[model samples]
Target: MEESKAGDLFAEGVVKHYEPELKKVEKQLNELTSKQSSLLKELQKENVKFSSIDITELTSLYQMMKEYHCRLIAMKKDILAAAERSEKLKNRAMKLKEYKQNIALENAHYREAQMKREQDLIGKPGQPL
Candidate 1:
């Protein structure tokens, strides 16, 4: 029981810390999504411009576009990883809560059993369990 209580406390602390960080990551993901959309549109526009322009300058621009695409992919990957970590923390917190509940229930059952044993031994008022 004590161990479970301590685990509950630790899980709560971890969950408390993780919640705000998860929100921050969510916000960052939103911002990154918007940025990615805008960049994609810009890349499309650049492609259109490239189609009409000379090849000499497009090489550098193409490199820049490729770099931008890579960055967007990396940001998406980071967001996925953050989401996974957040889910793990949430699951841990829920399990801790369940553990605490189970411990309390088991303690109650034990106490009830002890009471029953005492009643059986005492034989209440000429009666027995």
Candidate 2:
């Protein structure tokens, strides 16, 4: 039971430690996504024609969009991995709690049975009441 409690606490700590980092990454991903959308909208407004815009400026915008896309992908992957890890830790903690509960319940049952046995012995012949 003690071990289970320790393990549960450890899992909770780990999850808590990473939770903020996970949220930060998710927030960055959302911001990046919004930026990407805005860039796309700008490009659409321009009809994406190379002849109307300076070549260098268009290329720069394209590069910036590309970089944002790459970063967004990486951040999304990071968020997914973090979420999976957090879920696993939560499951482990829950299991540990259940195990601890089972242990406590078993101990209670054992003590009850032992007390009943003592009472029976007290009523037995030649045994102290």
Candidate 3:
């Protein structure tokens, strides 16, 4: 019984750990995706109104575009890693569920045994009136 309870706690700990990791990855992904999207919108706005811009401004815009491209690449890698970790998190949750169910079953068996013993004691024919 103690062993079963310990196993349940260990499984719960594993699930708790992976859940935070998954949230961190998700937050990072959201930041990167949002930055890339904002850059795209800014570029679109420039396209409609910047054909007559000076050379210095054009150079600055080009640099920003290059940086955005690099960030997008990094974001893609993060998303892939996050997907893999999500699968691991799901498996961990399943294991935790199974461990808890097993413990409950063991506890129920113990209670049922106690009840049977009480019944036997009450029915013993040699007992005092």
What's the number of clashes in each of the models?
0, 0, 0
Global lDDT scores for all candidate models: 0.96, 0.94, 0.95
| Candidate that scores best on lDDT | 1
lDDT of 1 at 129: 45
**lDDT of model 2 at residue 124?**
62
Candidate 3's residue-wise lDDT over 13-60, tens digit each? 998989999999999999999999999999999997777678898899
Error at 99, model 3, angstroms: 0.4
Q: Candidate 2 on 1-129: residue-level lDDT in tens? A: 999999999999999999999999999999999999999999887786645779899889999999999999999999999999999999999999999999999999999999999988678677654
Score candidate 3 by TM-score against the native.
0.46
lDDT for position 13 in model 3 = 94
TM value for model 1: 0.44
Best by TM-score: 2
- The sequence of per-residue lDDT tens digits that candidate 1 reaches over residues 54-106 is 78678888999999999999999999999999999999999999999999999
lDDT score of model 2?
0.94
